[model samples]
Target: MNEEQLFKQISLVRQATLKQLESVTEAQADEQPEGFRNTIRWNIGHIYVVQNSLLAKFGGKPVATPSRYIELFAPGTKPADWEGDIPSLDELKQELEEQPLKLKEVLSGQLDDEAAQPFLSLPTVGEILNFTIYHEGVHTGTVKALKDKAAK
Candidate 1:
């Protein structure tokens, strides 16, 4: 897809993710239900971190996430091992709300540029950005499931 279309998708997907967390409290976001390795909070933070990382790595944009976000939410890290000051649900939601605009600002017109390296055989910055939509959807689903489980 083109740059405008991709940014639209990013905004829509992020809106859905933010909507999914509308009712989640800070405490609920922290709950790790059975069979789940991470909490809703972790999933949200992961979504933000992964999107920024992929965009920076493959799209040639600078990383927009805080260094500590990588420590808490990057792949292979889980809530059980979390330490230090975790961002509140509100803080994460704010980040999620603002990320799309930042992405569009930085990545506009650069989608067709070559990736730093191929990822999953995807060779362009836009293609990698597209992959992040799928990644966010998976984590958003996880957040929904966690929210449901937490409600029970």
Candidate 2:
């Protein structure tokens, strides 16, 4: 896809993900229902962290996310193992809300550039950004399921 289209998709997908959390409470954000490994909060933070990290790592953009987010939400980290202060749901939402614009600002005109190192054979920055859209959708679905279960 072209850079404009790709960034638009990123924004739209993020909006859908945020829409899923419209009714989620702070308590619900932290709830790890049975059969789930992480909470809604973790999924949201992961989405933010992964997108920014990929853009920085593969797109030659500066890292816009805080280091603490990597420690809290990077792959293999889960709510069950979390320690220290975590961002509130609102804070995460703000980050989520702002991320796409930040991505566009940083990555515009650079989408076709080759990755510093290929990831999953996604050799171009644009391809990796495309992957993040799918990744975020998966986590957004998880957030939906977790929210439903937590409401019970």
Model 1: how far residue 55 lies from native, Å: 1.3
Cα lDDT tens digits, model 2, 67-135, are 999999999999888899999999999999988898888788888888888878999889999999999
Where in model 2 is the C-alpha error above 4 Å?
none
> Candidate 1: how large is its RMSD?
0.9
**Would you list the C-alpha lDDT of every candidate in the order shown?**
0.90, 0.90
lDDT of 1 by residue, 64-134 (tens): 77999999999999888978899988889999998999888887888888998888899998999999999
Q: Candidate 1's C-alpha lDDT?
A: 0.90
Q: Give the 10-residue window scoring lowest on summed lDDT in candidate 1.
A: 56-65
